[model samples]
Target: MYSPRFIHCLVSITASIVAGTFLQSTTINSEGSFTNARQSQAQKVQVLSVEFPQQQVPIVRFPRDVYPEIKFSEITQPQIQVQANKHLTIITIPTSLLFECGKHHIAEKAEKALNQVSQAINNRYSGSWLQILGHTDSKGSSKDNLQLSEQRAVAVQQWLSKQHHLNVSMVTTQGYGETQPIVSNTRFDCFERAIARQKNRRIEIVIQKLDHQV
Candidate 1:
């Protein structure tokens, strides 16, 4: 038969072994959880770092050229075309609207459109350089067309100076006779040819900034 004291001691030893095993298991699990938490924190930091970059991109811009403004509403002429760019502004008027056929004189009926042009120059672009370019269609001999174009340009310059009292020194004139046609004049139909020729006959007022010498 076993002694009571020996059995009590054996029971105490078994209890101690079980308690040791449970403590060891708890310690290992706690360490694993702490490691996992640290790993998750590192992953969050990495994701944030990727989403926001450290360096920033730079923006670039070009400088605008100084130029004068033209009010389009002030020009009531339907046939006039006003075009502007970074460096120059061009006002194109059909010669047929300004003068009679084969004539270099400005018609009295065309005073309204000319008045608007003069007003624009006097208002905003008086200090700018003005170039009056005259063009003719393929109607007459090249020599005659060239002379007519020059005369027309000169007449416009004179009218602007004498009538409007603008500075004549700022204005210059040129003629391109049947050479710089805006449309093709080789159409087989007479009406189409006439239309093309009419479109080709025009006077262009080119306005440039003071920095550019005409």
Candidate 2:
């Protein structure tokens, strides 16, 4: 026996309480979903970071004229040849100019040529890679020739670093012996063979252009 107005009041109160409870539950669920989405995005970013790492140093080549300080005419000589391209600048010196027969010591006649080479490296080719490749004629045994060639290359490298105060780390030496010859070492004609042998015995100075400049 509740009055009509009282019953109506109770129903309205219950409805309001139910509506408030439902709204609060909806709000908590929405917050949880938003948090989950943010965590998922962060996890994705972490995965991407682990997938790709930093890179190493890159090797780069340059066109000729990159270092215009090296003069081709001044470095070139009667027995020495200078060749340049995008990859390397090769300076070929006859073995007779740098060394005596069966010896690795730098001769007195080689001072002028060596001075020019040192100047070029100091002037424009600083911090660049240098390779001194030694070659010989086909007169000695393969093992002996190889050792001699390596010795010659090392001698030149030492002279450059010691005399000119060039960076030693930037220089490397290798010996090809008689394996790479510019002319044929023939035995048929004595005079022709001697000429060919002279051409074959040489040292090649290779300078490579680098991306990193000091």
Candidate 3:
């Protein structure tokens, strides 16, 4: 018994009401989600801001007297016999220092003296040269005495070269057996001539061609 126009009008009104209700509900839900998200971000920021104090490090100190120490071994000096002149210095090694009874080998006790002599020669006469002369007594045969004297001189030269590290070219050696005796040969009843001749047996070290400017 209802009319067609009225039925259509009622259906249109019902659809409008349902659409408005759905739109309102969607808007409320979106607003609530946005508010909840903003609150959670604010709480996270507060938790990151905590009260923490800075701790200072202490400075360490050392003793004022502390210093680097240096240590060295003590070096004992050798005894030096220096005879310096206006031109040159003559370093003499006694026969007893270089040899025994008619012997040619150098004594171990004389090493210090030889080293001292070599050092003196090296330091004092840098421009000069050394001459080593060997002397002997007249008791033995001329040939044998001459050979012995030569051997003695060579022994001295070897010591200088080996122990003192001296240049062989800077030194020259010669032997004058009984021929260049310092004391004259005399026959006396008191053995004075023998004693004097014994003194003649020796080695003479002479520095020559010195640089006078030194």
Please give the distance, in angstroms, between residue 189's alpha carbon in candidate 2 and its true position after superposition. Answer: 1.2
Per-residue accuracy of model 2 over 75-127 as CA lDDT, tens digit each: 65667666564445667789998999978888888898898878866776777
TM-score of each: 0.64, 0.63, 0.56
Candidate order, TM-score descending: 1, 2, 3
RMSD of each: 34.3, 28.7, 47.7
lDDT of 1 by residue, 1-214 (tens): 2234423432332122211111111112222344576754443221212232343212111112322334476687788877664556678889988899999999997799899888877766767767788889988798999899999999899999998997778878878777777788776499888899988899988666434423
Q: Estimate every model's Cα lDDT from 0 to 1.
A: 0.70, 0.69, 0.58
Q: Pick the candidate with the highest lDDT.
A: 1
Ranked candidates (lDDT, high to low)? 1, 2, 3
Show where candidate 2 strays beyond 4 Å.
1-71, 211-214
What local lDDT does model 1 show for residue 185?
A: 79
As for lDDT, the candidate ahead, 2 or 3, is 2
Predicted structure 3: lDDT: 0.58
Model 3: weakest 10-residue lDDT segment is 59-68
| lDDT-best of 1 and 3 | 1
